[model samples]
Target: MLGCLLAADGTAQAAVSESVFLDEMPVVLSVSRLSQPINEAPAAVTVIDRDMIRASGFRDIPDLLRLVPGFSVAYTRDNTWAVGYHGLADAFSRRFQVLVDGRSIYSPHFGAVLWSDLPVAIEDIERIEVVRGPNAAMYGSNAFLAVINIITQSAAQAAGGLVSVQYGEQGMAGLLARYGGGDADRRWRVTLSTQDRDRFEDTGPDGSGNPVELRERTHTYFLSGRTDWQIDPRNDMSLQWGVSQGDWRGGRVGEASEPARRESGAAFVHLQFHRIPTPGREWRGQIYYTRNHYDADALGTIPGWPLPVRVDDHLVQTRLNLDIQSIQRLRDGLRAVWGVEWRRETVESPQNYFNQGTLDGELARLHGNLEWRVTNAWLVQGGAMVEHHYYTGTDISPRLAVNYTPLAGQTLRANISRAYRSPTFFEQDGNLVYTDTGNNAVNVVTIPAGSLLKPERLLSREVGYVGQFKPLGLEVNAKLFYDTLYDYLGSQKLNTAQCNEPGAKKCFQSVNGSSLNLRGWETELHWRPLPHLDVSAHYARVRIDYEAIVLDVTSTIIDDDLPDSAPRNTFGLLARYGWDAGWQASAGIYQTDSITWLSDGDKTTGYTRVDARLARRFKWQGYGAELALVAQSIGNTYSEFRQENLFGPKVYASLALDW
Candidate 1:
């Protein structure tokens, strides 16, 4: 009944006319593993194209996500950022899924994305497609909230040499170089980039400096290569490899209260093959390997402390994944996809996060789906995946969706899905150590293994509408969604007999004692009033209810604080203009309502920020050159979550040459 009312409201507001498909409408492929018109996708999705990426004036990859609806972006430290969809965020985001090309980038040790250590550079990206709802049936575990696919530009699109350099306030400097060339049948591209920046100045609510906080600094370097080969008329292959390394100083040190040091390195390789034997049928296979190494050393002496203790953390992990899938036309208006996947993950640490000297895990899955055009005006889609894991036994995820086209330019859809998030290695087998010196001798405390932990699960329902008005140069997407999450990996104090030390204090293990309910509405609009001008707007409202039964736990525990920072209202707007005479400019604004941070449960003031960019292109010796200026938080000083992580005005200028 509520879904019906929402659809009727959208129908009444839609301006119906002689609608025709535009020749240049963007097509997306993340929804069902096949290319389809954006309005005809099986789920609520937002695609940010090259034009939008260039106009956003965001140098980092995570900032680009602000353009999408129902997403939250926050800064934690100098180079650490947190991004979430529909509002469960932490220093390391664990609920969302992120992929580069076809390779999952989630770390096996902690099941989190290290945004600052990603290998791909923003300049090499072609487009980003974000799914606003769960897609576990198609993407597997850890896709419980949303999925982000970052597609890089093909070698054909980058056919020459380019150089770019930028310098800005806050001790920021960046340099990038790329070269691309190939024959008609084969192509290759290579890129190298370096970045350096300073952390936000620690300040109080009144914009005054606080002496106890330590400042941070960061430096990063990256190198990447990609190649594509057309072996024959019916076969093709592509390979990509990259490496990224960075170091930073932050956190707190001993008695004098200095900064600590941390370093990380990552490398990845991906290979893909495609075959097209006949029309209406295709097959593809992919394999990838990733490695990550991280180390942190932090220690601080409290008032009246006698000794300096070690507060260092370290981990090294690797992952290998392979998958194959086939897409075939079943009948006149029906299509099907079937696939299998095998994954292996292994990790090693200094006996800090795992009890054993080493830890390893494996997973296998089989999935299938069907897309049936029941009639000219109706479509139905269903899919399911069966996964087998070493720890949590076998589990199944499923989804069902239906679309109704009542008019030539409008589509309405209703979808329901079941998704799960498998426990990370750290959660299942963690042995973190804490030393207590109150008794004159070290009393080492360890977090016991969660041998009985279960996978987190989500049941979600959503209603969505998409409308296109080519005559008016407009497109709109809106959705209403509800979610119920259960079996979350929370903690509970164990009985004396269950603890390693029978009478120890603070001995805990993970359990399933939490449930969360969330409901929200999101809407996005795009309008092109003229050939050279465009505007986009997005808005969202969300509400949540949470309950947990964890005995004797602090309020800062995971289950108690996960939803505290979810803002009730969020909005963004963007406008861009291009002139025929080699000039372009863009401006944008975003706002988020005040919310309490989980780290300290401190409420922060709501903030509004503005960003802008201006550029001019010219030819020099038959080569293209561009000069641009970018600014963020133009005239405001605000904090996203932490008072020390305040955001102030920033300006930078860049020069680029392409041949």
Candidate 2:
């Protein structure tokens, strides 16, 4: 549920008319691509509303995800972050899908979301809906594990000029400005923001394994605009565009890290149209274009090389996607929704692809879901998606769910689903080679892709219970899930016959080499005991088992690291209160058990984080203004992803004004 409403029209519908507890349950639109209440949806979901966003006092979108159950977040460096669900996650969150206003933002080059340069600002988001299990039947490939949908506020809500500025320790500073204006039929808004901060005081060492000190820091800027128009009584449309750019100072060209300076940028344009043919029917279409660019230049010395090597890491990625969907009522108790989608992804990189020219791929999908109320106490939902990809041919993902309601404010749900994840271009066409001044391959980082790669598949089963107590003003959601993954992609050293390329030596290939299984239970509680107070808490327990482990002498996939990548227990708590007429206070506490990060990450011990925020909201000089003070990580230094990177106490102050 999104802490918002979603009527049959499906475009963030206004509040409902009835006031019963069941009728007032939070509504959601991401599950099954249909508008329904939380208890009636097929899967478990977590919603982060605007109020929680402000109370958490987090500037990074990934950092704010700590509130979600069964999620793990790590800071790999100044510009890199890793987020995963269940387990088996590296620097790239390959199995997860993320969207902003129905536009997918997954990168084709690295198989991950570019968190450092996301196009939208947190202040502009209305809410985030996170589906906790496989949802490929509604979304497409790469929705193998979870889905995160970020919905921004409508243009009409941002109808005034607003400004915010902040300063903090460790070179933390930021500024943001927004303005909006329109008439009854048309509305528009624009946002501009910039920020700079330091990530680590000193990087442990360079590639050569020598004692060294390097400061890692980053600076960023973003601009975005949105427009909404109500052309007529039954039609409306929206247009949105944004661009974000950032620069990070990093370590030299070491084995694990690269570049002294890295520049990253992202841009996107999204347009959507909606039509309401009748009171119970609607059609919507969306088209989006997105691009990502990266550039890095550095010089380094290999252990046995005679001369320095020039490292030029440059990459450009682009995506064009379009989709249309329709929802109509067939009868009194039955409704159906269907959609079609197409997308193209392209990548250009000489350094990474080893002289391979620009590469591109295409994908097409068709999907439909039916929701039928069998009786007053029983509801059933089923859907399937068929997708054709340039690499993996065609595949189908399907889901079936059942919901039972014995009483008005209580519901029981069960779901079973299957999903697939196509192999990324990096996994298929990787050719990493280090060249010296003489143009000779000095270090064979990797050879090339294997021709026999296949898509990874997942099977998810879950049972859940949700209940809302109107008198207590409390909500409880709990679930138990079991998941299995097959044909898992892993790396291995290939022999002469196993090498797909002729005359290839010491080939490092990607293969369908392993399987994984996970079982877990998680719970979330939302309590608003008083009119001026809000409290939320969550807990998760996970157990991971490896059916097969891929081992390569030259690879980093160790036996223990694969099974210990996920924490066994996780907990979080959040609280907000209005202490006085103009005073507000909030606090959050989070803890994670010991776990190991795969690929470039390291083993870390259990850690706990605490944060507090105090603010005063009032009207000054005929303008809405707020002054806030925040304290974060109020404890001893703790490691994030690596032992070298430490987190400590920090304080910041900010002022926001609206006119």
Candidate 3:
């Protein structure tokens, strides 16, 4: 059936068309901070362009990442998603790094990215570059397994105005508007967006519906703007600012839940300057500031109380980052990049820190890299970064890679690297205070110490291959990786009786007596058989072994087994077709092996699912309009995390106008 659809697309060449679409190219930037073909990239990489993003039929950024091999995207709740590269599968996957337009979006409070707080709209994205391997040498700490960079369309490219509206079942409604203008030397663009959706029906781990309703509603609002100015032919400046706010509710069904409601807000500003002093010599300087605030509240009844009690938890964090870099071309076939960065952060959250009203942290880093073409068939690249943090003091990360091109269209690469994840504010000083009122009794709360936390480290090796068939318009990339992690940080609660203090407090703290061994293989293939037809396939296999070696209350060191959710196998296939008559269709199928939920010891059965989209485009009075219908989980209901997280079929329609 899939082959027939691609073959039939050749006959409808004149029935459908798109205003802007491009084939997947070999160009990428995550490897060396410069545009280089995939065959020469030092590490495995994946590029998601605008055309591919549009055809995926995914409304969220995390969902689109599912197309990449080795990436896991799980829908934990109605509005919360957990994304990871190799699968620790926690609510906050903190090992990965994320950046938007050269500005880091990962928060220092928990060392996690707040996907829902990102201000940029999906329509404003131009491309996404993902380095599918550890790259701490180039990017700093937290670049443990992968690095994602999202690039938005420039004001000049967006031009005019665009409005998009979407409606669907389950009280889903969304709107996005963008306006762009300015001359060649000066350009600006502004965007506003909103989304609202109802909660899914209450269900248990066995996929049986409960009597009560689950509070899982979500709503969001965002506003953002960007500007660019060309000071001269050798210099340019860019500025950006954005704000995002949202409210969501989540908890178990048929229970009076604590922390059931959450409100989140984020604001940021970024400024950058680029200068080309001479040929083969370029320099850049950037500064960015971000503020993240969140509040979680809930009302619950106590056993002995006649009324419900309200509890509040709040966190506020602010960060300022500055960086300067220079790219120099020493000679033909030789290039290098060197940079320095400094970051300062401030936190004000009495809930998490208790009496500590506010605190500050700082970090400084220096890095350099060199890409040398040793010979016609051999390429060598090496880099290292040295960073100093308030908690861990100083550390160094280094990486080296060699690429060999034996044939015209084939390349092989071998890489070795060392990466580290610095401790977050929460891990270093979190209190995690909570009250339990049950059976007419109130238990004492625990106070924790995070000051002894240390950074986690990983040593990894990888081998990759990139092959291209120009005649067939096909590209294939495959990689095998093995990693050994030490001093893995984990949460633990110490017994109060073991302490010698007056209150003998039972404190929760971050511990480092843990380790993990992970191995994986992934492959991605892209084929463009025709101008209007495209096909892609991805597959991955992973395994994990983890051990928690810690000191117990008896002062004895013991190694305990830990649960993991790393799937043994996963695969996906996608196809898109377009006709000249303005008709287009896309379909995809995804399958995953059984996975264990580390939290509750529940297992999620393996399942296969399908998604599809169809659209019609029309032009009236020089304005382009499109109407599209999208469907997810076209077959029977399936669970991505657990049965209670069951996601059934959903259909929505959207209309977009561009002028």
Candidate 4:
């Protein structure tokens, strides 16, 4: 119904009548693999709809996550971002899983989401569902911290032609064109977009209190299309394909070592067949293939250095997946969903792996969820996943949740889950040794993958509440959690007989050396007064307590700063209103405490950011048209990711037309 209302505009909208009812609470599927209202789900979920997306004035989909509680989002570079949940923010530790239309996009090379290369346009998204806890019991491995499910509008829902253009500060320029058409039985939509942006004014501190500069400007292009076909009364099919490529300028003023062009791209093709034979029975089969490639090496002769052999980043990653699932009613007031998945992931790199040609991993998993209703106000959910991976032979993840309703619009929830994440390929078998241009060893060995690594384990427990205030049109979702992370994958300095250097004689390898206790509370508040006004707010507080399982690994103690990964407090508020004459205005306030990024990231100071936007809709040749002006970070300049990476005010205007 929300999708229908958003797609209708005003002409075909739902009539304003007493017979019509709108649900303030959302129904989500990412929780227990079942479609249930938030009050009944086992996890805390945050839904970002199209209305908020448009009003936020964010050009990148990642920036829109500021509205979600306990989410830390920052830009490490002009073309790269670090996104984390609760704690453990990093550029390489891709702990969480992201799904686009049920297709996982987690890369196999460095275990990171290729944010800059995502083949998705901001405007093409319909909604995003974020599950704010470990969901490995249903999503398999790598869904360690959370799961983000990005749902795009169907071809049928977006049947028209649209063109939008944007130009903003930092030399930001973009253009998008979309066309969609179909009949009742079949529909398809295609979107093509390109964005060109310049690097930030400052690229971070280069030590000596001096600013460092590299041409990190980027130009990106994307082409995404979707097709929906209704084969018969009981069958349907969907085809989704997307391609993206980006070129980033990279060079230093006096150095020839930085790669002149940083290249990154991704492509994917997905096909799914769905069957619904009865009202309470359904099944789906899907297959997908994805490829991601990147080339950005920094190697040049320095003024005082004699060697210019810096084996920088260059890699290719691919994934092929097949899955089948069934959802059905087991009995009265009872439901179940079962599924199986098989996948192959491969990574090819000469720099990181040295002589290793291609590294491959095969994985298979079986998962199931059951929902039982004991009474009119009591619901019990349980699920587990049995998975087999080349890295971790076989493992079982289990989850259980209980929900009780005390009144008409209030519910209480208690949940506990156990999950695991295997060490990434880079952490397992990587031989990351850089050599000189003459193939001679120029640097000492570090992080040599010496010791065997154990898969990280997690035990999470949470108590939550969901409430709806009918008279005030308000809905609240909140949770308090205590999680224990065991077998932490930290690096330990080890004695190596390889190239001996006076400055660095020891190498490092992954080890289970540290443990952590995460305590946090997060909440969401949303209120919408139909037709004119909408308000959304979020807040969270997190504290990480670190403990060492063993600090006697050699002499150095690593990962002690892991407890500083997240801030102590964060909050945000956004409000939008519509007035007469098709005029609309919106404002947002965001705040976060100081945070320290992990693995080469710097500790950044806390800052407050304010944004506002104004727009008006009109008819151009009888076609809907809108012009909007947005101002971001109207406050003073602040640092992000690094102290020298300054973030300043920006203003931009966009014109969107539907024909």
Q: Which stretches of candidate 1 lie over 4 Å from their true place?
A: 1-25, 202-212, 252-259, 298-308, 434-446, 492-509, 550-558, 599-602
> Ten consecutive residues with minimal summed lDDT in candidate 1?
1-10
* Model 4 misplacement above 4 A: 1-22, 203-208, 250-260, 302-307, 310-312, 444-448, 493-507, 529-531, 548-557
lDDT at residue 624 of model 2 (Cα atoms): 95
lDDT (Cα) of model 2? 0.81
Clashing pairs in 2: none
**Across residues 1-659, which tens digit of lDDT does each residue of candidate 3 receive?**
00001011111111111221232346665666755678888899988888788888787887878888877777666346677677666556688878887777787877767787889888998778888988888777888888887777766667799999999877678999999999878888999999876635455455454343456778889999988877777777778899999998776654554467789899998877777799888777778899999888666765765555445568899989888878799999999988889989988775566566788999998888899999989999999989998888898999999999998889999999999998888778765443333212122233444356678899999999999898998999999999988887765556666433233355445667667888989999999899999999999998888756647744322224233567788888889999987999999888888776443334678888899999989997787999999888886577666566667788889999999
- Quote the lDDT for 408 in model 4: 85
Q: Which ten residues in a row have the lowest lDDT in candidate 2?
A: 1-10
The residue pairs found clashing in candidate 1 are: none
The C-alpha stretches of model 2 lying farther than 4 A from their native spots are: 1-23, 203-214, 252-257, 493-507, 550-560
lDDT per residue as tens, model 1, 94-142: 7877888778888777677878889888889877888888988887788
Residue pair clashes in candidate 4: 257-299, 257-300
Instruction: Report every candidate's CA lDDT.
Output: 0.76, 0.81, 0.75, 0.79
Quote each prediction's TM-score.
0.91, 0.93, 0.91, 0.93
Q: Write the per-residue lDDT of candidate 4 for residues 514-538, one digit (tens) a residue.
A: 6789998999999886769999999
Shift of residue 177 alpha carbon in model 3, Å = 0.6
